[model samples]
Target: MTTFHAAEQGLAGLELMAKIREFERRMPLLSEEGLIRGSTHPSLGMEAVAVGVSLALRDDDAIASNHRGHAHTLAKGADFGRTMAEILGRADGYCHGKGGSMHIGVKELGVLGTNGIVGAGIGIATGAALASKMKGEDTVAVSYFGDGASNQGVLAEAFNLAAIWNLPVIFVLENNHYAQSAAIEDMVAQIDLSRRGEAYGVPSFSGDGMDLAEVYELASAAVARARAGEGPTFLVLDTYRYLGHMAGDTEIYRSADEVEAAKANDPIEKLLGQLIAEGAITADEWESMSARIVADVEAAEQFARRSPFPDPAEAFTDVYAKETQG
Candidate 1:
C-alpha cells in the first residue's frame, strides 16, 4: 500500500510516467483527424501536476482544473475512455457528451469541473471548501490554473475569501511560463507568482512542478495545512507545456532552441531515468510499458471514435442546472 505519510512514495514512479507519455503521443492524433473540437490544452510536458496532486489527494477531496485539463481529470481517477468520448461529444463521456474537453468532471469523484474561463474555477473550489466547512466535512478543495490566470482579478478575489475565512482550499498555479503566446516574464512584472498569494495572507510556496516527487511533497504540505484548518496555500508549479497554445498555433514567437531547451529536461524523461537508475524499472521492461501505453491510447481512441455523439437537443438541456419554470 502507498502511504500518504511519505509524499515521495505517494507517486507511482514508473506507471505515472507511462501515463504522461501515453497522452503526449496520442493527443496530436486526436487533433489531426478532428475528433477533438474546440481548444484542447495538451498537458504534454506538465504531467507532474496531475500525477503529483492526485497522489496527494483523498478520494473525497475536490478539484477544478484549467481549460487545458485532460491530465487533471484523468489524474483524479476519471475513466480515460469516458473523457475521450466527452471530448468527442459522445453519450458515454463524463458529462453525457455535453461538457467537452473544457468541462470534465465527476461530482461523486470530487472533480467539480474544469472551467473554460481563466481562473474562474478558483472561485468554484473556494465555494466547495466553504460548503465543506458548513457541512462539518474535513475534505479539501483544490484549484489548478496556469500562470496566465494570475492576471485575472477573479483569482485575487478568491484567494482573499479563502484566506479571510480560512477555507480548506489549495490553489495550484501550473506556471508553464507562457500565457497564450507571450512568456511569463513579458506577461507579468512579478515572476514569482506565488507572492501574489501573500497579499491574502495565504502561505505560498513554489515548486519544480516537472518533478513528481517535488510536486507531491509541496501538495502534501498544502493539503495537510488545509485539512488542519490553516486556510489556503498557494503553490506555484514551475513546469512547461510541450505543445503550442493550441492545435493550430504557428508557434513562431519562440525559437526552436527554446523548445529544445525545455525538452532537454522533459519531466517524463527525468522520471523514467530516475526509475531506471533506482532499479524500479529495467530497459526492456520500460520499453514494454511504453508499448503498452501506446496501444492503450490507440484503443481508447478507437472506443471514442465508435461512440455516438449525443442528440443535438440534449445540448440545450445540460447547459444549465435549472429548476422548474413557473
Candidate 2:
C-alpha cells in the first residue's frame, strides 16, 4: 500500500489505486486456481500508471492498450464483474468470452481494444485520433504499449503520421524495464523511450510511473495538448511489474532478491502510508476500505465462477481481418 498525498487529494484516487492493486493481486491467484484459461499477464506492480492516466481523461476519451491491460480497462471505468467473467471465459465478458485477458475492451467506455500483438494498437489509436479530428470531435485517443512495443516500426509510423497530420493522439509507453525475461538495457541502446518521439518533432515527457501524481500531471498536460490541436505527445513511464511475463513464467531471468527490493516501493503501500500521515484516512478507515475491496473482488469471482460459458456456435462470430490499403 502507498499513501503520499492520498488524504489531501480526497478518497477517489486512493480508492481507484486500491482497486487496481487488489485486482492485480488477485489475478495471479485466479490463474493458479485454474479459473483463467489460456495465459493471463498480471500488471501487479504497475497500477499507478493505469489509474493516473485514466483519471486524467474524460470518459469519452479513447485509449488502446497492450496485453497486460486489465488495470487500464478497469481504471477507465469498465465493469469489474464483466471483466472477471471475461477472464474466466464466461458469456457475460466484454467480448462475450472471446477475448480472454489480452484482447478485452469496453467500447462504451471508449477503450478501443487491448492488443495481444505487440504494437498493434498504436495504429488503431492513431486511426481513432484521425477519425476524431475529421469528425470535429474533441476526443483524444491514447495508445498504451510496453517498452518492447516501442521498438516496433509501427510505432514510428504512427508517430510520423500523427505528427504530419496534427492528429490528437498520445503515445504512452509503460517502460517496465523488461520485455519478458530480457532486461531492457540489454535489448535497446537507448532506454529513454520518450526521446524516440522527439526525433519526429513530437513533444515528449518522462517521469516516475510509480508516482501517481507525477503520472497524472504529465498525462493531463498531454491530454490538454491533444485537445488543443497540438498534435501528439509521447510519454515514457518508467515503471515495473511484480509478476513474470505470463502466469507460468519461471522467472529464471531475475532473482528473488531483486523482486523483494522492488516490493519496498510498492505504489499502493506508499499512498496508504502518506494518507494516514496526512490525516486523510484513519487506520480504521483504510481497513474498512480494504475489506470492501476484498468483498467486491470475491463477489466478482463468484459471478465469474457461476456465469455460463459462451456457446460453441458463436466462436467465429466476431472474427474479422479487414484489408488495409497499401
Candidate 3:
C-alpha cells in the first residue's frame, strides 16, 4: 500500500472519488423521475479506476470513454453542473443537449467523448495516439473500456496497431466480473485479461481496482512508461459495479448476496479507511468534505432541472461542418 500523505494529490483524489460516487448515486433517482430519458449506466462501485487514472494523466492527455463514463468525465475535471445538465438533456450541456448520457464530450478537457458502442472508444483513442505521435507530441491517449468490450475485435486491431507503431496509449480494461448479464468466465476462454496484450508485444498489468492507492500506483507507472515513449501499456483493473448494467435492469444474473459480498470491498470506504488510518485526514474532515460534495451534486441537479432544452432547430445544426469560402 502506498503511504498517502496529507498532501494535495492524495486528499484531492479522495474528494474526487467521493464526488464521483455521489454523482452516480443520483442518476437512478433522476431517471426514475423522468428527468433523464434514456438508459444511464451508473458506475456505482468503480470510482477508484477513474480517479486514479485521471491523476496520472496530464491536462493535455486525451481519454475516450465507454458507455459507463460519468466517473471518467468527472475525474477528468469536467464541470459538475454541465455534466448533470448534459444527462438532463439541457442546452447547457457539453454537447448542447444533443449527446445526452452516453455521448458527452469536452474538447478542452481532452475528453474525446463517451461512446455508446461497446468497443468504439478503443479505436478512437488509438487514432488520437497516432495523431499525437505524428505531431511529435508526448501526450498519451487513454481508452477506457469494460470487460464486455474486451471481446470486441477492435481491441485486438487497436492493440496491434498501437504496439507496431509505438504510439503512446493506455488500454484500461475495467473488468467488473460480468459483461452486462453474462459472466466473464463464460465469454472468454482465457480468464486473465491482463495477458491479452502479450501476443501484441504490449506490456500488461493488473491490480485491485477497489483500492485507490493500488490503482494510482499502477496508473502512474503505466503513464510514466507511455510518456517516456515506451509505447502502449494495458491495464486490467478488477472491479465491480454495485448497480445493474443500466438504470432499469432487473439484474437477474446476479443475486443480492453476491452484490452484498462485492460491496464488502467498497472503494470509497477502503480509501477513507486508509486515509483515516494514516492520520492523513480525520473522520470529521471526511464528513465535512462528503457533505460539501453531496450539496454540490444536489446543486448540479437543480441547475440541470432549471436549464432549458435545446431548440428544435438544433437538430439540423452541428450535423456537418460549415463551408468556408476559400
TM-score leader = 3
Please give, for residues 1-326, the per-residue lDDT of candidate 2 as tens digits.
12224544436667887877777778878899998888889898898888888877899999999999899999999888899999889999999999899999788999988889999999999999999999999999999999988889999999899999999998999988888888889988987778889999899999888877778888889998999898999989988888899888999999989988888887778777777887888899989998999889788778888999999999988777677899
lDDT of 3 by residue, 1-326 (tens): 23434465578888998898889999998899998988999999999999988988889999999889999999999999999999999999998888899998999999999999999999999999999999999999999999999999999999999999998999999999988899999998999998889888999999999888788888888878888899999999999999999998999999999999999999888878877887889999988998999999899888988999999988888766689999
Clash statistics: count for each candidate: 0, 13, 0
Q: 2 or 3, which is superior by TM-score? A: 3
Model 1 lDDT tens row, 180-232: 89888898787988789997799999889888778888888888898888899
Ranking by TM-score: 3, 2, 1
What residue pairs clash in candidate 3, if any at all?
A: none
Residues forming the 10-long window of minimal summed lDDT in candidate 2: 1-10
Best by lDDT: 3
lDDT of 1 at 179: 87
| TM-score, cand. 2 | 0.94
What are the Cα lDDT values of the candidates?
0.83, 0.87, 0.91
